[model samples]
Structures are given as C-alpha cells and as structure tokens.
Target: MITVKAPGKLYIAGEYAVVETGYPSIIVALDQFVTVEISRSKSYGSIVSKQYRDDSVLWRRQGDQMILDNRDNTFNYIISAIRLTEQYAQSLGRPMELYDLKVNSDLDSPNGKKYGLGSSAAVTVATVKALCQFYQLPLTKSQLFKLAAIAHLDVQGNGSLGDIAASVYGGWIAYRSFDRNWLIAARNQQTLTQLVNQPWPHLKITQLTPPKNLQLIIGWTGSPASTSHLVDKVAIQKSRQHQVYAQFLQDSKNCLEGLIRGFKDGSLDAIKAGIKKNREILQGLADFTHVPIETPTLKKMCDIAVEHTAAAKSSGAGGGDCGIVIIDKHTNVDSMIERWKQNGITRLSLRVHPVIDLNKE
Candidate 1:
C-alpha cells in the first residue's frame, strides 16, 4: 500500500487580495491532515472516506478514464485529482492501474463540523501525492504543487490556491499566486506533464523559519462558512467597485510583505503588528463590499485577544469559523481562553506541521 498525507492550512494574512496574480499571502500547515491509502485491486476499485462513508465511489479505468458506477458526485475534489494525475501519468507513458483508495481525515470535528482548515485542499493534495507515488513519478516539489493547484482549480474555479501550496510544501510559507488566465491558456495548448514541468508565471513559494518565541492560538466560533461562496461575493464587489478593490489588493500586498519579512528576520513583534494591520485592512474590505468578513462573533474574539496583549484576526474568508491569535510563547493564555469560553468560543490546540520531503522520507 502507498499512503500519502497532506496537512490542513490556515491563512495568517492576505485573504481576498491574494487571488490576483503575484499577490502574496502567509499560510501555515497544521498538524491535522487528510490521508489517502491506495492498494492495488484486480477486479475493480473503490474510493472510501471516513468522513463521507455514505458518499463513496466505485469505479474502473477505461483507457485512462475513471468511470464511476454512481455519479452522485460527492467526491469532486478526489475525482479531479485522480483524473488530472492520471492524465499526467499517461503523458509519461505510465499504464493505468486499478486501486482501492481509502481516505481518512482529521480536518473536521468528530461530529462532522468543519473548522475551516482547508479540508478540500488537503484531500486533493493527498490524493495527488498518493497517485504520484503509486505510479512512481519523480516530480519535484514545485511540479507537485502545480499539479495539485491545477486539479484544485478545476473544481474551485477561483480564489488563490495558497492552501494547496501549504499542503504541498507544509510548514509556514510566503506564497505568490500564479496567473490563472495564463494557466488556462497553457492548459489547452500543452500536455498535462508539460504543463506542470514548466515555470508557472508569478507563482512563488518560500518556506520560512519560525520565530523562536512565537505562539499561535486558534479559536472556533462554531459557525462554519463557505470559503468559495465568500470569495465569489468579494469578486462581485470587485467588479462594481474597481478603485476600492484595487486599493485593497495593494494594501494587502504591503501588509503581507511585512509579515514575510518578520519571518525572515525572526521578529515576533513585527509579525503581530502585521496581523493587526491585516485585520484592519480586511475590515475595510468588508465595509466596501458590505459583506460580513468579520462577523459579530469574530469581533468579540479579536477584541478579547487584544485585551490579552496578543494580535488577533479572522482566519480565511471568516464569515464565522476560526480566529487566529499571535503572541509570545511565554504570554499567559489561560485567562484569554477562559474569556473565550464565556462567549461560547472554544480554543483549539493546533501546532504547525513541519515540511517533510516525501521522496527523502
């Protein structure tokens, strides 16, 4: 059996603005992961997941195509990964193989509640990694990220694929998204393997060293939000309010640049200040778009963190999912978490997952 794992991610800074080409964002991979285990099957193949036991796929390969027995489509992300990865494999003259793919995830609560930790991105990356290992393809880290980004974009259709990069690269990273228009044009003109092997214009990923005294705290608001839906709402506002949207992009880029610098220089204060600045910028965006980027609950969460001398902000699209708190490792957080409990906020114990080279490991 060939097994692969992809860690979930949370955006530290630069949310909506990172969708534009060359815009930067800071994201960290968490310890939670989606794991895929692929085993050979002679007769037929099935795709099963613990999260969606009732929603699975039974399929067979027909000339490099995966034909599902039931087309309910509960596994669009996984199916996209399979099709795209197999297409790349075929480009390398690799024969198709039938395998039973089993997936397990800890990206959600036991009750099946989402924590907004990029579950889809994790699953997609894990699926792609598993297939690459199964087919024994020697792909570089950038190539792996590009292939996963392409598959993820096939389903998501929009937004920066920073989460996919976090999953592929792991640890903390400063990410600049590639131009989607260029990728779309190239996809039609080049083979799958050729598309991944080329330099992705404006796409950049730099892994950073974490500050020695830095500490991150996550708070769950118990209300899950749709990232793609929120992204789409912002896209609508972008069309109607061109000047405001453009300003937002520039402000976000400036804020994330400082955040990235903090990592390079090992400055915790700079990082915290950058988080606060990013929070203020996101509020401006919410005001301009009239979208609830920071909901009432998120406001309370951030306010409480400020009281504790820590910088806080809503993570990701943040209608209501999780809020991130950045502080020194020696800072007292018990009182803050107690305050959070008073407001029905739950503190999550999550740590950054380190980057490991799959080939080396």
Candidate 2:
C-alpha cells in the first residue's frame, strides 16, 4: 500500500490579486490533512473508495466518468483529481492500474466545509502523491505542482493554486504565478529551498506551533463564494483600471510587507497592524472582489470582527468563507468566540506551524 498525507493551507495575504498580475502570497501548511492509502486490487476493472460517505466503491471503466458517492457533493473534487492523474499517466504511455483507494481525512474544520481551509486542494495533493508513488514515478515538486494545479482548476474551475504549492513544498512559502503560465514563480524558489535545506540551531519543529496566547480566531460568514466567479470579476475590474482596485492592490502589497517583517521579527503588534490594514484593503475592493453572495455576509463579519479585535479580514478566495481576527494576547478569546456563536458564526482555533520536509522522514 502507498499512503500519502498532504497538509491543508491558509492564505495569509494576496487573495484575488494573485490570479492576474502575479503577486506574492504567503501560505502555511496546516497540521490538518487528508490521507490516501492505495493498494492493488485482485479485481481487474474497479476502483473502490472505501472511505466515501455513501457510495463506497466505483466501477472503473476505460472511458466512463468517475463517480462519487458522498451526498455533500465535495467528493467530486477527489474523483476529478484521480481521473486527471490517470489521464496524465496515459499520455506519457505509463498508464497505472486501477485500484481500491481508501481515502480518509482529519482536516475537516469542526464547523464543516464553510471554514475554507483548502480541503479540496488537500485532497488533490494527497491523491496525486499517492498515484505517483504507486506508479514509482520520479516527479519533482514543480511537476507535482503542475499536475495538482490542473486537477484543482478542473475541479474548482478557478483557484489560486497557492494552497497546492504549499502542500507540495510543505512550509511557509512565498508563491506567485510566473510568466510561463505556471502556477508558481521560480524567483522565491531559492528562499524556500534554503529554509528547508538548512537546520536552525535552536528551532525544533516538533516543539513549535503558533504561540498559545496569541489571539487568532476564524469565524465563518455562512456563505460559500465561488472562487472562479470572484476571480473573473476582479480580472474585469483590473482591465478597466479602476482606482479603488489599484488602491486595493497597493494596500495589499504594503500590508504583505509589514506582515513579512512581523514574521521575521516575531512582532505580534506589527502582525496585528498588518492584518487590520489588509482587511481595510479587502473591504475597499468589495464591489469588484466579491459576487452578490459574498458582499453581505463578509461585511457583517468584518464589522463584527473590527468591533472586537485589532484586525480582521477574509481569508482565501474571500466573498464568504472565513474571516481571521488578530487580537492581543490578553484578549478573552472564549468570550469573543461565544459572542460569534450567538450571532450564528462558527469559530475555528488554529495553530500555525512552520513547514517541514516530508522527504526527511
């Protein structure tokens, strides 16, 4: 059996802007993950996914579309990734055998699918890795990234690809779309390589996690925004050279700089300030950044978060997924969570960890 575990990701900055003129985005791989275990089956013509919620096994066919049995409709993304990988293998004259693939995940947010923690991307990465391993394919990280991006775009239609990049590379990564139409830029490649290749004298990764007392809360806005729709809208707005859009980009850039500095220096105050400024910038681009489904709920969450914390902004493709709030270490997180609960918002507590090399273990 070949087992692969892939990390979920959270975008700290540069959401919509990353789609067009590539901007730097910082994403961290979370401990939560999707695990895929693949083993050969005695049967010649079937693909069985035992961990599926409803339809546990699918009959494989040469030209048939993949089937997913999950009632939640999220399982389709997994099926799409598998089909794409299989197709890619065939194109290279290295077709893989159909197998009984049992997929399971511990990455679902307690609040469910609305938390926007890159569940789809995690599944894609995990499945891709497992398939490659099963085939004994020697693929570079960049190659894996390209395959994952194709799977994601096929499933989600429009995605930033940053989440998959972080999952494959496994660390805090500064990623951008490059001129080659590839999802990741090569400029920041060396920085990521250096961090992974060298060991810090005092940093023990197993002992490290996001600080316990730091106030970071993720609140759901009760709406799921279509990433593709929002990206298309933003693209149109940028083409017109809207002033608000320009300011939004500039603000995001400035905010990213501040956050990078905060990350380097371990300054909580600076991080808080950067998040606050970044939220404002996102709010300014609301008209173009979000479709109708995103505006109302996102605004309400932003308003509520601003009232209680130092900074709050929508994470991921925005519109309405989750909003992250930065508060002082001493803030009453429990009380704040209760308040959000009363307002029908679910709260997710996350511990951010530095990326590690999966190949090392």
Candidate 3:
C-alpha cells in the first residue's frame, strides 16, 4: 500500500487580485491534511471516502481511458487525478494498473463542516501524489504542483491555484498565479499529457520564511464561505468596473510586497502597515462590488485583535469563514483568545505545515 498526504492552505494576502496576471499572493500550508491511500486490487479500481460513501466510483481502464461504472461524479477531483496520471503514463509507454483507493481528510469537523482551509485543493494534491507514488513516477515538486493544478482546474475551471501550490510545496510562499489564458489555449491545442509536460514560465512560487518571533492566530466564524460564488461576483463587477479594479490591484500588490518584506525583516510596524493597507483595499473592493466580503463577525474579530495590538484580516474569499491575525511572539495569546470567545468566535489551533519529499521518506 502507498499513502500520501498534503496539507490544507490559508491565504495570508492577495485573494482577488491574484486572479489577474502578475499579481502575487502569499499562502501558508496548515498542519491539517488530506490523505489518500492506494492498495493493489484484484479486478476493478474503486474509491471509498467518508465524504463520498454514497457516490464512490468503481472504475477500470478501457483502452487508455478510465471508464467509471457508477458515474455519480461526486469525486471528480480524484477521478481527474487518476485520468491525468494514466494519460501521462501512457505517453511514456507505460499503462496504469488497477488499484483500490481510500481518501480521508482532517480538514473538516466530524459533522462535516468545512473550515475554508482549501480542503478540495489539499485532497486533489494528495490524490495526485498517491497515484504517482503507486506507479513509481519520478516527478519534481514543480511537476507535481502542475499536475495537481491541472486536475483541480478541471473541476473549479478558474482559480489562482495558490492553494494547490501551498499544499504541494508547504511552508509560507509568495506565489504568482499562472496565466489562465495561456493554460486554456494550451489545453485546447494539446492532449492532457502534452499540456502538463509543457513549460509554464508565468507561474512563480518562492518560499518565504518569517522570523521566529512572528505568530499567527486563526478564528473560525462557524460558517463556511462559497469561494466560487464570491469569485464569480467579483468577476462580474470587474467586467464593468475595470478601472476601479485596476487601481485596487496595484494597491494590493504594493501592500502584499510590504507585508512579505516586513515579515522577512522582522519589522512589526511595517508588517502592521501592510496588513492594514491590504484590509482597506479589500474593504474598498467589497463596497464597489456590493458583496459582503467582510461579515460583521469578521469585523468584530479583527476589531478585537486590533484592540490587543495585533494585525488581523479576512483570510480567504471571505463571506463567513476564517480570519487571520498576526502578532509578535510576545503578544498575550490567552487574552486574545478570551476576547474572541467573548465575541462568539471559535479559535482554531493551526500552524504552518512543513513540506516533505514523499519519495525520499
């Protein structure tokens, strides 16, 4: 049996702006993970997961194509990974073998409430890694990232892929989104294997290690946010308010750069300035688009964090999910947690997850 794990992710900055070309986002891989296990099977391949007990697929290879018997389409992420891996193997004159797979996630509550920690991206990365390991495919971290991204984009259709990059590489990273137009054009012109094998120069991921004196706290608002719906709303607004969005994008880039620079140099004041500036830009975007990207609860949480002399902002495509706070290591965390609980916010115990080379391990 082969087991693979990938960490969930949180966006520290550059949420909407990263969708456009050249804008960069900072993302961190969380300690929480999604795991995929693969074992040799006798006749057919099947998937079983706590999230998809009712919608599992019993699949088999039919002349270079994976055919599903059930066709429920619930686990498209897993299926996409399998399909892409099979095609890549075939391109190298190696056919895929059948296997039984099981997926499990620690990204959700036992009751199945998602934490907006990039669960889908994590699972997609895990599945891709599991398949490659099972087949003994030698792929570098960048190669694995691109392969997982292809499978993930097949489902969501549009995203920055920061989450997938974080899951694959781990640690804190400054990532510029890939050129979606270029990727779409390439997909139209080539097979899946050919598309992944091509060079992608636009995507840039750099590991950014913060000072040891830095600290982060995540607070869950007890509600999940639909990132796709929020992104769609912003896209519609961007179509009409192109100039306004263009200015916001520029300001966002500056703010994100300042944040990373400050963190790297251990300048608390500079980091605070960057966090506040970025929050203001997001607030402006929300007002311009008439979307409640920052909910009342998120506002309250940030307000409380500020009262404690820490910097805070909404983490992801925030309607209502998690908010992040940055502080010095000497900040009184207990006091902050008490304030959050008083305001009905749930504190989540999460930290940065380190990346491991699975093949070496």
Candidate 4:
C-alpha cells in the first residue's frame, strides 16, 4: 500500500491576472488536506471514494467506466485524474495494470468544492503521486505537473494550470506560458541543459504561523461559481491596452514581492499591508473577474469585519466562494465569529503550513 497527503492551496496574490499573462502568484499550502491510499488489488480493478459526509461510497471501474450513485459530482475530479494518468502511462509504453484505489478528504471548508482552496488540485497531486508509486516511475516535479495539467484539462476543458503547478512545486513560483516548440528546443539544447543540471544553494523554508492573537476568518457565499466560466469571461475582455487589468496585475506582482520579503523578515505588519494591497487590486478587477465582490450574507459579514479588522476580500474564483479577512491582533475573534454565525455566514479558521517541509516527514 502507498499513501500520500497533499495540501490544499490558497492564492494570496495574483489570482485572475495569472490566468492570461502568466505572472508570478503566491500560494500558501494549507494545513487542511486530502489523503489518498492505493493498494494493489487482484480481485477488483476499481476506484472508491469516501467523502467528508455520508456513508455511501462512490465506486468506478477501470477503462473509462463510472458508477456514480450520488448526485454530487465531486468524484468526477478524481476519476478524471485517474484516467489521465492511465493515458500517460500508455503513451510511455508502460501501461499500468488494474488496481484498487481509495481516496478520503478531511476538508472542513463549507460546500466541499468552493473557496479556491485547491480541493481538485490536491486530488490531482495525490493521484499522480500514487500512480508514480504504483508504476515504479521516476517522475520529477515538472513531469508530474504536465500530467496533472492534462488531468485538469480533461475535467475543465480549459484551466489555468496554476493550481497543479503550485501543488507539485509547493512554493512560490513564477510561471510564464511558452510555446510547445520553444519548450522542446529549450529542453534539448545543451546550454539550457547545463543550466538546468547545475546545482543551486539550498534556501530554508520558515514555518510562519499566524499570530496567536490575530484572526484570519473565511466566510462562505452560498452561490457556486465555475472557475472555467469566469476564466472564459475574462478571456473575452482581454485587450493589450486594458489599463485597469494591466495595473491590477502589476499591483499584484508588487504585493507578492512585498509578501515574500515580509515572510522572510518575519514582519507581521508588512505581511498585513501586502495582504491589504493585494485585496485592493483584486477589488479593482471585480468587473473583469465577476461582480458584487461578496454575496449579500458575505457582505454583511464583511461590514462587521471592516468595523474591527484590517482587510477582507474574496479568496477564490469570485462570483461566490469564500471571503478572507485579516483582523487586528487585539480584536475579539470569537465575538466576530459569533456575529458571522448570526448572519448565516460560515466561518473557516485556517493556519499556514510550511511549503517546503510538506513531503519531508
């Protein structure tokens, strides 16, 4: 049996802008995660998933067959990941045999699939890890990323590929889209090969915990939005001279750079400032990303947060998911949460996990 735990991610800066021009985005791997276990099974070549709620099990067989007994389509992501892996294995002339895989998630966030917390990306990462183990395939992070991208495309048809990249690399990454032919030449050229093969100095990853007295609150908006839909909408409005969008991207980039510096120096004030600036940039692009910023319930919660907090902004694909608020260290977090409860907004309390040390132990 082989088991791997993949952490969910939150994009702190550069969410919508990253989709088009491939700017640098900062994402933190959260403590909340999904655990996948795969065992060699000679009896049945099937996949089974036990979600966060209910006793009913979702099962599917190998070779493009599905057995969905429930109404929820949450299991589709996992199935897509599995099928994509199988296709890649075949293309490599090392087709995998039938095996039974079981997946379980411990995600406590509302609506299981919202919040841009990387629930799908986590499953893709974990599935790829398990397949690599099962096939005895020695795959690098880049290879895993490519395979996961294929899986994401299978599910969504069009995707940003940022989530999978973050999940595979697990740290701050600057990604730019390159032509397929250009990538091929770069991979094969001797100069690029030498540069890639060179060893680099190791940088330590600090596990920075949120301040004990400070409060980070995430409130859910009832509406469910499709990320692909939002991406398509933004693509239609893409013009080179879109100054607002361009300025938003630049601001996000600056904010991300500030965040990196703040994180390194352990400056909480700088971090808070960066978060606030990033949220402002996101708010500026609301029309391009979606409208209304936060839901009605979420707006009320945000009003209460603004009265006593530092900043608040929608965390994910917008339209409707969850909003994150950074509060002052001296603020009453419990009372704020209680107020959110009274207003029908679900509050999710989360902490940051070290990006580099995730796979160490």
Model number with the top lDDT: 1
User: Using Cα atoms with residue i matched to residue i, what is each candidate's TM-score against the true structure?
Assistant: 0.98, 0.76, 0.96, 0.75
Q: Candidate 1 residues 197-272, lDDT tens each?
A: 7898999999989799999999999999999999999999899999989999999999999999999999999999
Runs with alpha carbons beyond 4 Å of true place in candidate 2: 45-52, 56-76, 83-95, 107-113, 180-215, 241-244, 288-309
Q: Better model by lDDT, 3 or 4?
A: 3
Q: Rate residue 245 of model 4 by lDDT.
A: 69
Query: What is the descending TM-score order?
Result: 1, 3, 2, 4
Q: Clashes in each model (backbone N, CA, C under 3 Å)?
A: 0, 1, 0, 0
Query: Any runs in candidate 4 off by more than 4 Å, and if so which?
Result: 52-76, 87-95, 108-115, 139-142, 169-215, 239-241, 288-290, 328-331, 356-361
Query: Between candidates 1 and 2, which one is better according to lDDT?
Result: 1
lDDT of 3 at 356: 56
Each model's lDDT comes to: 0.92, 0.64, 0.86, 0.63
Best by TM-score: 1
**Global CA lDDT computed for model 1:** 0.92
State in Å the error of residue 160, model 1.
0.3
What is the C-alpha lDDT profile of model 4 across 88-108, one tens digit per residue?
565556655657777877553
RMSD of each: 1.0, 6.9, 1.5, 5.8
Which pairs of residues have clashing backbones in candidate 3? none
lDDT of 3 by residue, 170-251 (tens): 9989999888888878878887666766677578888887777778789998888999899999999999998998999999
lDDT, model 3: 0.86
Error of 3 at 105 (Å): 0.2
